[model samples]
Target: MNTAAFSSLPLNPALLENIASLGYTHLTPIQAETLPPILEGKDVIAQAKTGSGKTAAFGIGVLSRLEFNRFNVQALVICPTRELADQVCKEIRRLARFTQNVKVLSLCGGVPFGPQLGSLEHGVHIVVGTPGRLQEHLRKRSLRLNHLKVLVLDEADRMLDMGFEEAISDVISYAPTHRQTLLFSATYADPIREISKKFQFKPITVSIDSSHHDSVIGQHFYQVDKARRMSALGYLLAYHRPESTVVFCNTKRECQDIASTLDNCGFSVQALHGDLEQKHRDQVLVRFANKSCSVLVATDVAARGLDIKELQAVINYELPWDPEIYVHRIGRTGRAGKLGLALSLCTEAELPRVKAIEDYQGVAAKWDEVAPFPMAYAERFQPPMVTLWIDGGRKNKLRPGDILGALTGDAGLAGSAIGKIDIFDDHAYVAVSQDSVDEALAWLKRGKIKGRSFMVRKSQWG
Candidate 1:
């Protein structure tokens, strides 16, 4: 049966209608291939990459089988990182739109455990979380999966590579033996197979060729001396001048070093790593997404679960040992039908890794020379907006509308002059056009938001 149109599937009519309303016209290759066995209550091992609609493939299955009234967790989705877990939970919520009263919760590290425990106590139908944090909850007896109907290991390969095998195993031990298990990964490697063998019950295998993104992503590789890779990265940035870019680093230390180096050199850059606190991480992401920062240097783990629209480029500061990881890193760009640029800085010692990527993709890489960063390209790469920090946020009853009203209303600024406004517990960050910074700062300094005067200052980034 052709399941191309979502209506053709055996999903709830409301789900089908909801998807149609959400602009899902047809099934993605992964969804078309995997949803059938999944909806039939069978375990599945699917080989699909990110942005391949794998989340929806598993999400729909989990939503369909959910017993909302049961309250206990009926399905559990484990991701390698918090960002991915949050994304998966959101996808599940969207799919469950028609399923009334369905509750989906996200559990991950770097968040307040108290809030998670409260949400658990209130009851939830599905739980999406990282292995380590999920294990912590289970150990505290705060999360129970005894009634779990489905267990999903999203990005199982990356989870194992990140050394979550023991945690994952411990989480699975708490689930009932009769439940369905689904493993989804970008590659069908030995570890993935091993995970499937241990967790899945005669799981039907589905492999979808996900080279579509490759067509839209323009990939280039450049050979540089080890010490000159950072210089090459700066030159590439100035030459390409992508509005939003993610620079991939092999380690947390490297991410921090590159971010600091680029910051000192006048590039608007932010570093994302596991070592960052949740609050600081949130601020960095907000700044990058709101256009206050132009470049984000992130390790693979820290970069996981980030979904940015219209991302123009991805720079590989260092090549990964695993070819699959290379694919994953470059996949962050070239999304939403937009053309993307992927630039990799390779060294003499990393030639084998480059070849491994070529063999994995079955295509010769496009090699290019490092373009010299002439003075003409210098001004083209700076970020166009600056972030303003407000000391008041949700805790102080500060809303985005209040801030916007303060700026465009009392401050007499145009609505178009403002970018994204992110509100957190005790602070908010607003992006303002560089041209209006002086006026914005002056106006904000004297203005009152929501009828109350609060201290405001321009955010200083390094």
Candidate 2:
């Protein structure tokens, strides 16, 4: 038997079958190295990047030790952002599909508290959530982890960067010290070490090389004048014309300014930063992920927990002070054995940062000159999809299938015309091909979804 195969692990037969059903024949490097210790019910600290199958590794461990009969929360996975928390919950649910009556809930802020409270009342075996909301529930006595068997701090470095150390410590204080603890982070910085020393008991450290290989991600740096930064960015976008790209900025203001400039220049763009309202943030993220938006301008802090698949390129409008952050930013792209592009613009003042990155990666910086491009080239770039927002969502018992059926069956549109359909609590968003937007919107307005009329309109970004 191949040691890299999932069957090599001591997993339940049903779980093995389910893993196979999910098309996971072999364990990812992170999973293969950490699953043994995780299954053995031991404390493990694994340093792995996003999209490394870490979620499945921890999700499997949580489910393997879950007590289905018991209503108490047996496993708690703390994440840095609500987006990440929701993603973790979804992955865990998929992993637990083999087992019946295994409850999993996501308790994140930016949504109604009453619903979370109600879910807690009904009982859940696994809870994946952020720090603030979890702290609120713990304070209200609506959530209790006295029976927690396994505790996981997913993206521990991001959590610490978001200043959730106190809340994480507080949440851990509620859990039993005798239980197993697992910490996963992309970078094992000093703070990460401190977190492990403070919480984990003699944790088995597992570090996977988080660095990107030169063969995988093509790194290019262009020297630009500070005043011509916006022009440089536009030239890059016009040059590459990536269908999906993320432009990483170093500040919230810069993030917004770059997004606005690109939007004015006729590119489908949105900004993600700490200052945006939660609803706006959701819209920005949904539009970007669904391909309705082409380029996403975001600060590192705001880009935490972003897991976009098949991202073509990553642009650093301004280099981060830390090389690890550069690695984390570029790591978002070139995932799953796909080619990735990392482009950077550095001014004379920032050349030192370039040297730092080169020294850290142990590779020379590849320099490229940005040739002038016609301004009209920017106008030619547009997203292939347009998103429509429906007034009703999960709260009104709406689902993706209902939206799809309405478009295909009643709207007389082919299924291929529709892209990704995302259903939220009070609203839903569906991506329609650019050619089908008008028809889809017109039909959605006159027609009914699930036999109920809904206000529908094309979503727009500022």
Candidate 3:
């Protein structure tokens, strides 16, 4: 019952103003309970799911204590994937906006090291990165953490699941022992506790569940023969027609097969797995997040740290052996007060596993029959947006505003026609309404951005 307002806390005036401007009046449970300890520079282990305002809890703490004048690394936030790292970096930057000369950099894999090295050479205040890339930089002596005052491990459980224990250990070894450490994860498993014991010093624990799972997300299980599992999945998709869906497969091969089948069947689909090159992986994630792809087929490992906002549904093609993962899978949807749907296809052999899930959740599973397969001539499912790849990006000083101006100003397209715009080191991806993709592409190819012409092409997604 600690219903306290954020103004009650001793936060910087500018930060308080920023929070208010962002429409946050009161403190979330996680922010109320954890921000105090975090701001006090005490070690903490917080158990909060995605979209629980955990980022701001930690972001506010780090930004408040930042030494902008020093210009050295003051905070280090390690994430499980490049996507999550980018997201954390963005949130932290947003929180630090009112604070002048505060620089936040994200260092992750999938991009070249030369640029990262270059940025490190220039110096930054906070560093958000993945274990692998950070470890590489540590080994090369390109990144130094001696001045590090705060160390936050966001999504600690997902990092462990991705097999980054050794990398995390090595990276932590480089950080000074006197720094404040914050470990935040959705689950408090034994391994997480072990890590907290080893690295944290008498840390306080906080767990909050803002999402009432069963109430917000409708869950259903359908039993089908192993041979008809794909058919059942397609039938479920056709029936639900979720604008954006994530289908989880147990194996990489299955992930690819299902994506291929769906693509062939005229569903806009993309497959994500460890086998994909970094370039392809980035494209897949961008397309899905921007609504250019209706379905994303992914393995557990590849889908780790995926935080897709407004995700309509989650389809569990195969359940994981651990019930905890099952919780995490369905948790992707039903976020941000949105109603979600979770459909699972199980065969006879997997019935026992289904029971385990039911027992874990402490609720009897609801059984449902899949809708009959759609007719051959049925309207095909297509995503509302289409992605266009532009060759220029951060290196060329490209900004979302620049692209937006070109599209809406010269192309004469409405501002609403533009979707998510992501700028990388050397390339940028912009999502436009499918109705305006051709015009946007043509305009970009013909128009100059920032007084320079860069190649523009449509991204081909299966």
Candidate 4:
């Protein structure tokens, strides 16, 4: 959509300011095609890859149509995890920056339910949340979706893959029958098709793909003995040191072990898996997204459906059971026309899986012998000694500014002296520069934000 066309839409003027401020010179392919249909209240099942501006397409539509003064949920956006839900909420808030009185609440598992229930009692116009948490709220009689006019299933296939189908159905059942339904996914599987068949009525369909699988990805594989794999991975990380990388593991135990080994080797690391509590999972994801933690040791299931822009590399510690998943794993990088790197360590036993992946992808992945091990690289891996999480968040009207204020203003630390600040629903996370850790902690313990003292510590913001 052109700027003039966007201006002509029935939207708040502040939203327009936000749009122009964000330098949205023109709409992306998905945005241009999906915006008009969504504006018309039509059901849509759009297949668009990450970084195609799909979030803005739906966010603006929902914000434009939300009845801000109704004091009831009018739009519901369901995501697979707290991280993605928080991200969606942030984007929607930016689009609604000019829209007055638009309250976007994020309901996800992790934080206490009392505060969420209290917020519900007050009122909310737009609800963005995980499927299970939204269902929980509905069961508790806190989130009233009876007035919902739009139901959005973002990353729909991922939700299904994560076993959220039943919860999604229950939440949607609470919404009005005439509500508009919009589904977005990286791929359209049969289960997703089943969802569309039942919840979406004659929806307009959209799919974006490259001419060939290899056209969209850069692929590579490496042959190594089983015992030397970890050392080889450590050497690779130290040599290449991509800005952001996701290390794919086959099992949760491996994810933890590799992360532990990397930490002991002097690298900042974190693990993402279903075994973690919702709150810690949110912290790990936030840190990864913000570059506070550059390496994510994750199971394929845990890493699937994550949408992180600017990921530089993908290292396969374990080949997936499915070839398409291998494609998806590497596809995390090389997204949006950016050149990407994919490296895999193939043992003699796992060469079959690597061959299967390459064969299924219809592309040849070049392999090379492992060069001599580098003790210099392995020596650099030191675990991040500490991480800090602030008790304040969006739910408490916390902003990055507030967290910064408490850190640099009252706490009297230099801005550069602080690290990443990730503010979510019921909390905010701030990384302290190793140089200023002690002082930062002491200053925080003595200061107040927004005229109130908040709980601050070296822990996840649960």
> What are the runs in model 4 whose C-alpha is more than 4 Å off?
1-14, 210-217, 335-338, 348-362, 374-379, 382-398, 405-417, 424-428, 432-462
Q: Per-residue lDDT of 129-178 in model 1, one digit per residue for the tens?
A: 99988999999999998889999999887888789999999999999999
Cα displacement (Å) at residue 415, model 2: 2.2
Question: What lDDT would each prediction earn against the true structure?
Answer: 0.86, 0.92, 0.89, 0.79
Which portions of model 1 miss their true places by more than 4 Å? 1-3, 211-214, 374-380, 392-418, 421-423, 436-455
Clash tally, candidates in order:
0, 0, 0, 6
Better of 1 and 4 by lDDT: 1
What is the C-alpha RMSD, rounded to one decimal, of candidate 4? 3.8
Give the alpha carbon lDDT tens digit for every residue of 1-462 in model 2: 124999998998998999999999998989988999999999999999999999999999999998799998999999999999989998988888898889999999998899899999998999999999999999999999999999999999999998999999998998888999999999999999999999999899999988888777999999999987888888999889898999998888889888887887788899999999999999998999989999999989899999998799999999999999999999998888889999999999999999999899898999999976444434578898999999999889999999999999988999999999999888999999999999999988999999999999999954
lDDT of 3 by residue, 223-288 (tens): 998888888998998888998999999898989888888877888899999899888888999999
Question: Which candidate ranks first by TM-score, i.e. highest?
Answer: 2
Top lDDT model: 2
Residue-level lDDT of model 4, residues 1-462, one tens digit each, is 233356656556778778988777567778877888899999999987667788999998888787777889999999987767878888888878775688889898776778888888888999999887788888888888788888999988788888889888888888889889999987778998999999999999988652235444556678888888988888778878776889998888998999888877667778888798765777787777766677889996777557788788899987777776776677778776778888888888887897787677676768765676643325454333346777878879988888888778877889877766777777788877667877887777777888888887876331
Arranged by lDDT, best first: 2, 3, 1, 4
Q: After the best TM-score superposition of candidate 2, give how far the Cα of residue 157 lies from its true spot, in angstroms.
A: 0.9
Considering summed lDDT, which 10 consecutive residues are worst modelled in model 3?
Answer: 371-380
Q: Please report the TM-score between candidate 2 and the true structure.
A: 0.97
| Model 1: ten consecutive residues of lowest lDDT | 372-381
Give RMSD (Å) of candidate 1 vs. truth: 3.0
| TM-score, per-candidate, Cα-based | 0.89, 0.97, 0.96, 0.85
